[model samples]
Target: MNILFLTLAKISTLKERGIYHDLMREFSSHNHNVYIVSPIERREGQKTTEKKEGNATFLNVKTLNIQKTNFIEKGISTLTIEKLFLNAIKKYFSKVKFDLVIYSTPPITFTGVIKYIKQRDNAKSYLLLKDIFPQNAVDMQMLSKKGVLYKYFRNKEKELYNISDKIGCMSEANVKFVLNHNSYISKDKVEINPNSIDLQLVTDVSEENKKKIREKYQIPYNRKVFIYGGNLGRPQGIDFLIETLQAKSGDKDVFFVIVGSGTEYDKLKNWFDSFKPENALLFPAIPKSDYDLLVQSCDIGLIFLHKDFLIPNYPSRLLSYLEFKMPVLAATDSNTDIGTDIVKNNCGMAVHSDDIKSMINAIDTLKKMDGAKFEVLRQNSLNFLKKEFQVEQSYFKIIEA
Candidate 1:
């Protein structure tokens, strides 16, 4: 089968495999033809507009240059690219028969193109959702519930939901949330298809490399290192992370290293500067090989989510931690569903999001865990992942569905 997948992400080379790219590669390796239409925020003056990687092809759209002045301007620019890119793809591929069209939503507005694909090729459509929109925005107070923008985005979200032949939610709570909100969507249509890492690559980092990484990052070989890497933004509730840093200011040996960029980077940096918890280190994003090496060097991983975001987002970063045989210290609430998984698998401790005392307690307990017990916990997580989160299982299930 030939599938057309749509996402608003920049792709230069295929080596930096994330969720969408991993899934597409899975399908392609199984002798399926997969093409992607990825929109970007900038070009960086690249010479090539499109490229191919093995069985998969990438379509890079040239979009308008616009500086966002406000929320309205940002929304308009996002939708404009969606309209132009989707239309341009349809026009270019008029003669090609696409068996299925899979579109993931964050912008929810792009489902308009899914409707068009279904009509044009009679293709089955899948909504692989990572985040549920306007509601998440509203929960974050990023937009007012009564605003015209809220209603517009909400209506678009519903339209997107209604268009999918199958809906792949990132977590069980998100699946349940969809079923409760839409009478048209059956429980069977909404199912768990959580984010995953390329297990092969994730498992390939060597112990020797890990030691080298530890030395490179200036992480003391004798101390416990807790690492968090990914987008640091609103949903992460980084202010509370600063609270964790402040609470741990006197601790001597434990190291907390944060690596990534987002809107909250400056805020987190400012707080880090003021506290300078002798142990905490801050750095921007590093190369994948270097990042993987650091993950292996760490003793524990950190996962954070806003307490109010009842919407479930199983961070893809968790799988990488599990792959490295490092236990997670998930700082989130009960509503996150992540805590449920951690407890079920005996992988790590889950602390209440707003409770600084609880977080400190978790940190202390994690610090004191016996080395052999830590290995046991890490093994349990690896077994769980191999049994369920492997990319091969995802390939079979998605294809069969």
Candidate 2:
């Protein structure tokens, strides 16, 4: 089978670890030809290129900056990407007949591209629904529900859905949301296919190495460390994150580590500069290998989402926390089932993003949890990851379709 994957994510190589990379690697390992088309954003200063390794072929198309840019550029990039991708696919993969076309959300502008391929090769289209779009923009108050932009994207969203032969949602809530909101989508077409990674054996950090890592980062060894490592953006509810840090300023037994960069980094940096909270440390995005070590050294993982989101955003960052066997503490909007799943599986605690009192209580609860019980949570985190988020599950789901 020849599989064509379309994404907005920058995929320079399959050597890197990510949800898409892991899934494509799974296909390649299974003796299927996997072709990926991803962006080389303007900010990257790279021309269009293609590379092949093993059974995987990568075609990176050049486009305007699609991520972490001003609204105007991001919008222009999103609007023009389909045409660019279609042209590239025609020029580079003209002879390949794709058996499956798997794409993810964020742009939802792939209807034209998918339509072209489906007609050209009679390929089956599969949507790996990761991000819900214009509605999420509205939830963040970035888009007006009554505006023309909203209507245009909303139409694009429907067209993308209508073109998809099957839709793989990240959670049950996602499936339900799509069915409830879009009456036209048949229930049989949607199922839960979540953000998964190619599982790797993680060696336990030695106590001495842990100490060295803590000393290197100026992290306290005695206190419980709670790390949040991912995009620092509006969708993450950065303001609430600041409020939580301020609330924990006086705590002596807990330390907070916030890492990652986005539009909201400057806002977080400004607050950190002004207040200089003793219990918290902030760093810009670090290398993935270093970040993984940092997560392994931490006692707990933290997830934050904006209170306004009606969309159930199950952040892939949760998978990282689980990968390192760290217990999770998620403060998210009520709509997402991520918090519910964490508590239900006995992996950790969850609270609404707006409730500072609950957040503090949950943190305190984890901070003081007994060793035996904490070990149970750690084990549970790994068990849940193996059960729900292995890349093989995602591979079989798409292949069986």
Candidates' C-alpha lDDT:
0.78, 0.94
lDDT of 1 by residue, 249-287 (tens): 678768888998877888888877776668888988787
* Candidate 1 deviant stretches above 4 angstroms: 43-48, 64-73, 201-209
After the best TM-score superposition of candidate 2, give how far the Cα of residue 111 lies from its true spot, in angstroms: 0.8
How much is the lDDT of residue 114 in candidate 2?
95
How far residue 229's Cα lies from its native spot in candidate 1, in Å, is 0.6
TM-scores of the models, in the given order? Answer: 0.94, 0.99
lDDT of 2 by residue, 1-401 (tens): 99999999888688989898899989989999999999999987999999999889999999999888877888889999999999999999999998899999988999998999999999999999999999999998889989999999999999999999899999999999999999999998999999999989977789899999999999999999999999999999998899999998999999999999988999999999999999999999999989999999999999999999999999999999999999999999999999999999999999999999999999999999999999999999999999999999999888787
Which 10 successive residues of model 2 have the least lDDT summed? 66-75
Cα error, residue 183 of model 2, in Å, equals: 0.7
Best candidate according to TM-score? 2
Model 1 Cα displacement at 368 (Å)?
Answer: 0.7
**Which pairs clash in model 2?**
none
Clashing pairs in 1: none
Candidate 1 TM-score versus the reference:
0.94
Alpha-carbon error at 3 in model 2, in Å? 0.8
